[model samples]
Target: SSPLDPRYTFENFVEGASNRLALAAARQVADGSASGVKFNPLYIHSSVGQGKTHLLQALTHRLKAEHPEMRVLYLTAEHFMYRFVQSLQTQSALAFKEALRTIDLLVIDDMQFLHGKQIQQEFCHTVNTLIDGARQVIVAADRPPVELETMDERVRSRLSGGLLIEIGAPDAATRRSIIERRIALTAQHMPGFSVPDDVIDFIVRNVTTSGRDLEGAVTRLAGHNQLTGLTLSLTMAETTLKDLIRVTDTRRVKIEDIQRVVSKHYNVSKQDLLSSRRTRSIVWPRQIAMYLAKSLTLRSLPEIGRRFGGRDHTTVLHAVRKVEEMIGSDEALTQEIEVLKRMLEA
Candidate 1:
């Protein structure tokens, strides 16, 4: 199977002030004609769901189609680490390095999750080798190189040497276009699926977080319409997406904010929450913070785990489920989490 998602091609990407420059740069890289040395290791950063992965894969797809002979490899930072670890276990680290170094184009996603000393050193060496050979490299992350505190400075410096672009949050017009595109795509599959302009405008105004959320809102409406045999209406949109609408007006919540608020509420230090204490005091607060981060932010489980002291993504999932179970059975805990949520959102 192809590593890239077919749906995330450049044709489907919505352009706006937020991501226009990033899109143009990505197209240039795909065409193998970007200005000399500037965009070789094109570094793209953004918060969650801001089309970094889409543009990366779109570039990969175009490169594969237009220059089929070029050796292109696209994988997330997690997968790269996994493969390196596997190579070490199998005693084929040399072969792995050789293969990676020889690729014509390299695309790494979620660079924030890349940790550990030896792996990062190897990554830096590979990037240097590829760039020195005039190969193209692209990387995406949740934040810019300077902000990746866990990553090695050498890796950050190498990435910083190239073009760094950020995809900002979509404005109102981009949000509308995204909603329209999603509705159009859905209509292709379900011919009766359509969102009225008023409903569309309602979604644009209220689902103001990211393109993914807007797509999700439209999906929910389409599901309801298909199941209940009712035409889309502003009332139905409001009713179906009440939760999203409620949070849209609030400031965007970050994982750091969740950790800080949860720590303060539980009377524990933020460091304690990120520590491996395993005591009830630290564990509960830690779990609560993870749950809040999962619920209030768009971070993936692994990304949340990385934020919370490099715990495994399954650990974050377990914490979330534990907090959820307690909230159902423990009123005080439920009230406490509610208070924490309000504080974070506030």
Candidate 2:
């Protein structure tokens, strides 16, 4: 009956540089003992399923783990509004407000859902009560304070007044790690289940958008295995995950998105990128685009070659190799590609 998932504890939360700041801030909020305003309202902002909810739940879990009797509450913004509305209609608003004030740590998720003047008013009042009482409050939203223009100014200010932590888009390495972690979690349920590293790398290279997508891939693979009782292999991964391959935002990553992002990053025109020009400028960007297509999609070398203005498989192979070599030694190029990959995935 708890709002927090029992499994979302600090031990399971995988951290990388992108999310390190947010994780540290959440831990601080959870450990601070002052009854007065110490990181009064910890604001966490991240795109969907980037571990903001996980971090919030982890904070709650740690608090309760450390202090069994501590008063705590965790609810989505929708649930908070629902309770507030129900209490008003039932003439028990006083009880609702009193109960909220008693919680030592109040965690709210999906704060972007808080809208409407009445709901905003109630949320603001509740936040004010918590902050004024020096009780810790945490909120998660898809956007930061300035972008959430619909929210009350006072509430927005209060949220921004304290610490603002952002759970950024996870990089390729981090995404791969997350996929491995999810696979390990799956193994806990199915004793002998296992997935190969290359298969996991395939999923990582393709499902670049969010942690949820990685989890979904793991779930699908597990479900398929459970039904057929077949061990997982690259061939199985290729066939079974045909739909999940190269998808971001619950849909397939179009060749156009990758081309557009790469072209923009390298300052080349899309037409020139796909054209026959072998200029050093056009060559490398074009190669990168091809490399991304190969790694992120199921497109065959010939298909990819055909897409790049009748270029041969040999040319595409050369480009892919050059980029891979550069990625291995060229730190600047690697960073550039990482940014582009993140954009395409986003």
Each candidate's number of clashing pairs is 0, 0
lDDT of 2 by residue, 1-346 (tens): 1367888888888888779988888877677653355576888887777888888899888887888788889889988988989899999999998998888788899998887788888788888988887788888998777656467888888788887888776788888788888889999999878887888888877776677777888999999899999888888888877776645552234567788888988899999998988799988889999998887655667767887887898888888898999999999999988887788766
Candidate 1 collision pairs: none
- Candidate 2 least-lDDT 10 residues: 245-254
Candidates' C-alpha lDDT? 0.88, 0.81
TM-score of each: 0.74, 0.69
Go through the candidates in order and give the C-alpha RMSD of each one to the true structure. 6.2, 12.2
Off-target runs (Cα >4 Å) in candidate 1 are: 248-346
TM-score of 2: 0.69
Candidate 2 vs. truth: CA RMSD? 12.2
Total backbone collisions, model 2:
0
Off by over 4 Å in 2: 33-38, 249-346
Per-residue alpha-carbon lDDT of candidate 1 for residues 1-346, written as tens digits (9 for 90 to 100): 1377998899999999999999999999888888648787899988778899999999999999999999999989999999999999999999999999999989999999888999999999999999999888899998878767678999999999999998878999999999999989999999977888899889988887788788889899999999999998999889999987775422257777888788877899999988889999899889889998888877679878989999999999999999899899999888878888777765
